[model samples]
Target: MLPQPNRQMALAQYRLRARFYDAELAAFEPVRLRSVGCLQLQPGNTVLDVGCGTGLSLELLHKGVGPQGQIVGIEQSPEMFDLARRRVARHKWRNVTLLNAPVASATIACQADAALFHFTHDILRHPDEVRHVVGHLKPGAHVAAAGLHWGAPWDWPTNWLVWMAAMYSTTSLEGLAQPWSHLLQHLGAVQLVPSPIHGVFIVCGKVLSTGSEVVHHV
Candidate 1:
């Protein structure tokens, strides 16, 4: 069986990477933009940012939601969370809320209009964590996720790149081939957006309403 994600190990990894996390993730900014765009956010919308590390996407998200909207960012690592908090303070964004807790236990008080899970492979692998985040969304709320994934079986060069990046960022390599499987299970009419970068994926979908029927995919 594939190993599950280790929270302690993830915390340790981010603790060390926190200082340079933003710089490290600079190359993936386009991926982040694409993921946030999948939300199709509007003014006054309240969005949940799952595993929001260092608040790199905050400015873009805030622009989409506008001043009337709300943003709730959840982060598990103190080192990372602290930087996110400082970013919010620096920008003086009064509408943003930061939760320094695991996504599975974070008290997300709002029924968000959308949620974005950017490069959150560890969180996506945890069923409980995905369930908790989905539960906080309003019916038919939009959901978008972007992250590294294993390429085609024969694509050794792509797979090698995915492996190296995953080793540095994710706590577990399990489900890298289908990282959005668990999240898609609760979503409806899912659509996979082609990623420009090899070994990466972007998926967008909406929460399934009670008794709602729809097609689902990764």
Candidate 2:
């Protein structure tokens, strides 16, 4: 197992990168589109954008959920949340709420219809965080996530790309081979697909009944 990320280290990392985050993530927009599509959101639906860095997924999610729909974004980094808050303000989006706290400790008042976890590798590795977020979803709510992962051993080029991306974005490199596995513990069986990019993956599934046992990690 990869060493669990130090919260302070992760915060510091995003604090420095928040300004350039949107620009740096431009190349992965297509993957974001694909991940959001898996949600199949409907009008007036409530969705949770976990680790919603710089609010990159906000507009697409808003488009899916519509004005009547509510979007709650959970972002731990203050610097990143500031940009996201500005984006919401600039857009005059009244239906959105931004939570400036880590997912494991954040309070999500309403049960959401769907949740998105685009590019949230570190969050995915923490089973407690996964369970806490999934617990707020209604049964059968759609959940989709996209992030980096290691490719096959022979796929050296892809692995290199994954390494570079993970080193820059994640606090630790644990679970790069199966970043979505912890999520599957709560989601049951997810339909996982790899993007054309060698070390990228998208996993989509619905929440099982509340009685389903959720695996908890410390």
Candidate 3:
């Protein structure tokens, strides 16, 4: 059986990452958003950002959803959560709410127009918990995940950092990308994204439900 991590460990892992999360993902969005336009968004959408540390992506998501839309970001790490909450609050993000909890445990109080589980997928210690993320989805919502693989390059210094991370108890997400496509099959996501990007791959897919509209391969 796959070993699952408790909430405490998960939080600690993110707290460590929060310190460097923004720097690591700085150049990621432009390349990452290549998959965003494919979600076929409209006005008045609600989005769920799993493992949404420090609200780094809150601004972009809010704009994408528009004034009539809403955004929710869930993060388990208290320190990270506090930092994210402060970032959003200081920015006066009226349309956004940040929650402290595991995304898999997040309650679906609101239906989402889209959902995202980003680099966090690789950090998930348990496979079933990864699958549990599906429970929080809204009907026919757009979903995507960005995962890193062996092919992603690291310079000597960063490579050394990666090695140290692997020795740690958490957030050492090795071998996460290879299994990500399996989720596309499990979730029955249509127009699923392709693999083979520079160190990481962003996979896109749509949730299909009644009254289907359109699909994009971003």
Candidate 4:
């Protein structure tokens, strides 16, 4: 669990990032597009984009799930949430709903068909928080997360220390592949698949309704 002070700091960081998040993340590029393509999402699926910053992931999730699908985004920072809401409104995404709250404390009201986290893991300050997210997920659901890990060669240690100093520790990531594996195993996800996405590694897995392997894409 992260210290309350640290969580507050992290929220502040995201609030600041919300201003230029779209340009910095470059959500419109093909790299981000293909990152979630393997899921083969269809209509009527309910996708929750946890920690959805500036709503970059929203557009694609909306497109993948189509008009029939529902897209809900949970953001902790009010500024970020405001920015995301504005972005969605500008695009006229009627099915997309932006809720301002942290992933762990946020009330989901309904079980998600699939959940998403893009560049959200590293920012998470503790392991337990991620596990808490899994505990709430419904069986037979799917999760897809893509993000830069600890040793990404971006002065990560410095950034980590800065974030940690504010109160909570940044996620202790091990390579781009570790975050997904750690959460998938903890969540008991079946038929797990891993892939590379630019500066990060992405994983897709299904939560078994009866703890059974479902299907294989490859």
Q: Output the number of the lDDT-best candidate.
A: 1
Candidate-wise lDDT, in order: 0.95, 0.90, 0.63, 0.63
- Which residue runs of candidate 2 sit more than 4 Å off their true CA positions? 210-218
lDDT of 3 by residue, 1-218 (tens): 33334567666666687777777667667645655555556678888777777777677777688888888888878888888888987988788877787666666577677877666644343465555665556666777766554343545554454445443534445443353544554344455455434445566676655566544442
Q: Tell me the tens digit of each residue's lDDT in model 4 across 1-218.
A: 33222566667666566677677556435555655674557788888887787787787888888998988888878888888889898999899877787676777766777777666754343466566566666786777766554334576674464344222213333333354655655444433344333334565776656657545432
Write the number of the candidate with greater TM-score, choosing between 1 and 3.
1
CA shift of 210, model 4, Å: 3.0
What residue runs in model 3 are displaced by over 4 Å at the alpha carbon? 1-9, 122-128, 152-177, 189-197, 210-218
- Candidate 2 per-residue lDDT, tens place, 75-113, comes to 999999999999999999999999999999999999999
Cα RMSDs, all models: 0.8, 3.2, 4.7, 5.3
The candidate scoring highest on TM-score is 1
* Model 4, TM vs. native: 0.74
Model 1: runs farther than 4 Å from truth?
none
Question: Pairing residues by index, what is the TM-score of model 3?
Answer: 0.75
List where candidate 4 sits over 4 angstroms from the true fold: 1-5, 122-125, 150-177, 186-199, 213-218
Model 1's alpha-carbon lDDT is: 0.95
Query: For every model in order, what is the number of clashing pairs?
Result: 0, 0, 1, 0
